[model samples]
Target: MSAESPGRRLGLRGRVMLTFALGAALVLLLLAVSVFTISRGYLLDQRERSAQRLASADADFVKRRLAAPNADPRAALMALDPAADTILLLLRHGEWISADGNPPPAPPTPSLLAEVAAGATTLEPVTVGELPYLVVGVPLGDGDAFFEFTPIIELRSTIQVLGTVLAACALAATVGAALLGLWASRRVLHPLRSLAGTAASIAGGNLDSRLPEDNDRDLNTIVTSFNSMVDSLQRRIERERQFVGDVTHELRTPLTTLVTSVEVMHRHAAELPDRPRRALELVGSELDHLRRMLDDLLTLARTDAGLHHDDEEPLRLVDLLDHVLAGQAATPVDADTDGPVLGRKLALVRAFTNLVDNAERHGRGLARVGLHAHGDHVLVEIDDHGPGVEPAERERIFERFATGRTARGSSAGTGLGLALVAETIAAHGGTVHCTDAPGGGARFVVALPLDNTPEDTIE
Candidate 1:
């Protein structure tokens, strides 16, 4: 009925790491693309200039040879040989001729021929045989045109390799950014984690717990503020404990006198009227109730003041319960406590006494008290034949002076008995909760961890 719900949102650490990873990826991708694009354009420009220069020189040489007094144009064209990956073509009288044995994969385009015939030189990039090529066209003095095709396969390969390397580096940088973000998040959240731990210790009654000194200016400010706050809170608690101790001493004398006077009056009841005798009994009962309330309050004050008896040695859960049950009036119980449990003797004795009294007073008398082994813990369960706690008020009843809860209904016996039980058990690192008993009654289960770790005290 009181199960906790888990958070579903991404934590601060996850968000921080994702931010770093995305930011690095975006920036690196942009940089990689820019470098690749710029390098590709510059390299292609240089190749075009080199190809144009080589083709222009060859065209000039063939033109001069044909222009000589005894020149034979066909012989001159045949003598012009180009490299393996290059193809040379000459246009005369509207016919195309190859200067070398190897012909171009595609014939010269009309655009290149028209531009050369217009007395203009042209350098055009085109695709031939599925490979990149630069076509250079030069017009001759004899109304012919010269064309050269050069393959740029090596330049394309270099650009492709560069692109691959940049992509890999960008991917690596993204991974490195994620790792960096994780480290930074842990480093930044360390102080907050410590603060939370210290707060929990203080809430669990360790008044002396404080944040450690920090060298960072901002962190040191928080450390100083937290320690100062705890110091103030501890001082106020100490003052309240002192007031309770003083009040206990001051009230005991008058309370003892009132009880004595009531007892003396009740002894002479047979001689008095019936109404007077009944009134005297009522006065005596109320006085006893008041005295119990005061005692419960004093015990709580002492616990908060850190006045618990020390844990001398490890004690088995069964032996401890046996000692508690043996000293009291006979009660039916089902015992199975077998493991070592760490606890303070006096505090645990009072806690068990309160549990028994609570069941008898609130739950129509104690049905049975039993112990069971629960893996690494021991459970001491008390059952009573009374209506079980309401599901909505189950957790509220554990609070000190809880407002309106059916878990500890009807404020009988000082309203502090269940609270004391919770406190004492919590001090020993245990918990007490209310649930439905097997026979449709109320069950109070005290779960105690079986820890044999040596300690100075229950605190």
Candidate 2:
């Protein structure tokens, strides 16, 4: 049998119902067999006793009649059974004679007659053609014997009906047990289903989702443990977010002061020595890099804390791409693809800028940026002509601070560009991924849903 057979593939509820049905069927079958056996035995025993008694009375009458002077044994035997269905016979002088003046349906076998003539009583069941009969034989004083055949068709019919009824009752009991098992399974697994739903809600970012209070002690323990674990996880996340937020907030003031001092030094650079002037320029560059990293960190922390909201509005896609690529050296291959998208303009701009910057820093420079409509969404492609990303690192490169082999040895980027781009696109109910570009290098594709209703809003 295959692994996915009907019996193996059955769910828990179905399996439970099957188990109950089989158990009930086995028990009912055994009970029905026992009842039928006992009832049939009792009925057959009673029937045999009645046949024996009737035969004995007839045999005694025959004996008395035979003792009388010039008595007719056949006449006495015939008078004992008025019904034609029953036959009486006499065995004497090695000849068979029927008392009713009719041939018996089945005559006694020689062995039976020999036993009767030897002074031993013989009782046997026999079938004559298709009819059933019980035969009883009694021996007489002169080596003669008397026999009677009783039809038992009615008794056979009764037992047959009883057997059918018992079988039907067993089937009904099995069906009832299966239905009861189904009800019990549903009732028992209801809480577990609810727990699964609650876990799904939490996994989907609804961390506040929790199981309802249950009075059942067995269920309450599981609910309490799950809720406690979620509580601890939520608290730990909040603490980490708060730590990032605090550090970023504290660095802002000092960063502002440092930027102002750097600008002042740059204004007076004409008077400084050449080496010191170059050093000041490097300091200014480092400060700018530090400031951008801080900003990226703050943005991530805010997103984690669910503090930022998208201001969605209808905006033309062609105009958005043009505005973002105005000063960049990148070429727009199909910026004329016209469509109005409902989104936050500022966030979309940031996301597009990050993609273009990522291409410039890691893949030499942006070769082309294109936009086109595809089904219910718009596709944006940013192609770069430099050495493409390795297939193994394609997905990992999108994670925060995840740099590729080429960028790892250099300080060209803070490694948060593609990560932010992924987050921002995801917030707009879109998806982003990288693949090998046509001819060479890497291509980043972003797909944004065209019908951006309020229900798709991201927090």
Candidate 3:
């Protein structure tokens, strides 16, 4: 990247997709957090309720069992410790029996026990061996009593496992949400990708490339706007080029006559008085040069406008060459085609005549003029015997007003000559180039497409 770089980094498609993905991801994260918070809280609340219910139910069942007749109350109480981690205590007539499991340290004291003995039920938090427990006490038959205790450690362990599982689920959901976000982003970006590609093609010089019509109004507007702009730009540029060419061509003939008349007058002006004649002659020569320039400009304009007359009919290159080269000695001018070009006879004559004239005017004589079939085109080569144009100057000379230094002094024609040749060849859907001739000097070759209607050929 240079300072002149086009300044586009992320294309429209990529930017659109990234935005979509980020939005989705954010939504997913919010949803996951909300769900995890509510669900985890609900699960823990339910677990707490279940722990309380189990403690109450076990206490009632043990009480009932101990009150039965001959129940070997101690054994009955021990039976209630299904997990073997349960603690049971029986007190009768001031006597106490402890089970194998250590009793809850915070069991009711004498005063609290007295209250229970007086037919009052008690359920309260207690501590045993530094561990918290839920203690439930109940009155027994005949002044005896029962106590049941449950440690909170088991409940804590269960909650820890549940918490772990919830956390894992939340982690997985977050990851899944990110992937979903990416997928959605891609869907939203597909059309943008198409738009970007079309834009790039147009920027690279294919003005005809356009985005496809889409039903989505948001994207449809963009595509329509871009296509419209391209259409207008192409049309405007073409019109400007045509206007310049036409103006140049329309000025040629008048300028040529003016310059020619001035030159003839100046050649004979020596017979008259010096001062006025010399000045008039200078004006005439300058006008002649100006006229030649105008003619070259007009030729270029016609080529650009594609307005050259081309009514194709059978016409031999041999005869046309003879007429064009009449009164001038030709080195070699041959027609190798099996048939005449299928185009406006006059325009073809002018095109080839211009090339021949240029060679003669600059090289002092025509070297050769011939045509050959190449691929799907016809190659017309005009060879001149003067010192060849340098490779560097070949392309430059085809520009407006360019003149090769060696030939510049000898020829008085406008620099628009080769520029016209290039444009004319292009108008006919063809190309022209310069290269080395077999016998030396320079060879100018024009390749014309041979397909399509003969009359449709470029003038």
Candidate 4:
């Protein structure tokens, strides 16, 4: 398999440190290689130059000794030797000679010795028996010769040790860089963690929680923006709540008067004319509308205040759907199930009832109700054979007072049925959404956490 993507698999700190460590190690390796390569060449060149100077001067001293009459050239060369492990070669009558170091039985050809003895310079690096050597050839007086060889074993050993130490240092530095990046990332992310906690608190019904202010310019800007957003949200929610409350309060007095007048007219229907009695009937109908509106308002208030109770228990979803559907006038819906779900019994019942009622009012009728386990959650779906909701307005229709029927001609409903369903499901720590049904029309699905233990199973 290919390597795991760092972005997908690695945590923030791990990714940051791994990237830094790899980059730093690569840089260190490149630097070490360049420095070592360059230094090796420079050290060899310096050694060669030193050997060249010493050999040239020593050859001159040997020439001077041979020039003095009656002086032994070998003895003179020996006396001039101020260093150990030296060699001296003299060229006489086109033949090569050496003193103070061993030589082969046959010296270099006459042309080669003449080339060296004529001061034709040669400075080249050579290796013998796996040992590095610097070879320099120099001329002596009138066909005399000198050759110098300096072993570079010590220099090679020093360079090798230096390279090893540098490599070790680079490795150590890479590790240090990785550790430093981890620490830096943690410090940098601490403020973000705090901001996340604050946002989560606000989401969990704590509107007063606010992000802490850090002096960092970027962080301060973020904190300011977040607080502004929360403020706007809180203000809007309060205004909507006040409007619902005021409308409910205003409708209460009119409703009471209408109800009292309708009851009186109903008792005296014989004395009152048919038209007046019909008007009284209209008043009773309007009273029903007012009561439903008030109840809707109260439900919205309770949802907003987070007042829903969650007494979780085992619930047989299929049995529940069968019972609710039996109460409806239409053909009983198909209630199918594979397993029970765990949730608050009363709230879930209310939610299911609202969904079924919504379908009955708007849809042709309820088509089916089915339940099954999906991974760790239990899914309950209600299918309705109605004109399916418009794709764009599906979510909007769940808002309070948002009805599927048009203002012109529509079924009378409080328009809070689906909204209540949404809220109740949320209180039970479940999710609800609408989509196209399998056969046709709309389907509403509620997914709640599954609990299959004996005590958690429905009868």
Q: Give the alpha-carbon lDDT of every model.
A: 0.82, 0.83, 0.67, 0.74
Give the better candidate number (1 or 3) by TM-score.
1
Best by lDDT: 2
Per-residue lDDT of 120 in model 1: 89
Task: Tally clashes: model 1.
Answer: 0
The lDDT-based order of candidates, best leading, equals 2, 1, 4, 3
Give stretches of model 2 more than 4 Å off: 1-8, 65-74, 82-84, 99-103, 109-120, 268-278, 312-345, 367-381, 404-411, 425-430, 447-459
Model 1 lDDT, full chain set? 0.82
> Which digits, one per residue and each the tens of the lDDT, describe model 2 over residues 226-320?
99999999999899999999999899999999999999999999999999999999999989988988898888887677676566787766778
User: Model 1: runs farther than 4 Å from truth?
Assistant: 1-8, 68-81, 101-103, 310-312, 327-332, 402-411, 453-459
Q: Which candidate leads in TM-score?
A: 1
Over 8-56, each residue of candidate 3 has an lDDT whose tens digit, in order, gives 4755444555565566566666766677677667765665465446655
* TM-score, ranked from best to worst: 1, 2, 4, 3
Better candidate by TM-score, 3 or 4: 4
Error of 1 at 323 (Å): 3.6
